[model samples]
Target: MKITVDRDACISSGICALDAPTLFDQDDEGVVLLRTDRPAAEDEQLARDAALACPASVITVTEVE
Candidate 1:
């Protein structure tokens, strides 16, 4: 699986950071930023949680096309 983030819509709510700190962090402007491209499979759940936590729906996850 792959994870992506859309910066324009991000508001840096820190939900993603709270949900998946290893995969995301709150930037100075308070936006979710991916720290790594390929996170562990075990962290996938947290990543998904983070994605869902975004009010702006800027996070994207894809396992296939």
Candidate 2:
């Protein structure tokens, strides 16, 4: 899966980091930090979960064909 984050829209909720540490993280200011845009197959679910869990809806997950 491919993941993307809107830094401008992030609210520093850290939900993405909390849900998927490998795919996401929080910066020093608590902004959403994308650890990887492309996640491994095993981490597909985690990426999706992080996107869905983002309170500001800043995280986006796209299925790779």
Candidate 3:
């Protein structure tokens, strides 16, 4: 699975960090940053939860399979 973050829609809610700190973080401007390598399969469910929890709907989770 691959994760895409819509920076424009992100409001720095930090939900992603809460769900998948290994895959997402906030920049100095409080914008969500996507890991270049994306999230691993083990973290797919949490990542999707984080994305869905985002009030801005900025996180997009795509399944490669």
Highest lDDT against the true fold, candidate: 2
Summarize candidate 1's per-residue lDDT along 1-65 as a digit string, tens digits.
68899988897778888888899887788977888766788988887887788888988877643
Q: Between 1 and 2, whose lDDT is larger?
A: 2
Alpha-carbon TM-score of each model against the true structure: 0.87, 0.92, 0.87
Q: TM-score-based ranking, best first?
A: 2, 1, 3
lDDT, residue 28, candidate 2: 92
Clashing pairs in 2: none
lDDT (10s digit) by residue, model 2, range 12-58: 98877878888888889999888889998999988877777778899
lDDT of 3 by residue, 1-65 (tens): 88888898788888888778888889998899987446666888888898889989998888787
In model 3, the worst 10-residue window by lDDT is 35-44
> Model 2 residue 4 lDDT?
85
Model 2 lDDT-worst window of ten: 47-56
Cα lDDT computed for each candidate against the true fold: 0.82, 0.85, 0.83
Candidate 1 lDDT: 0.82
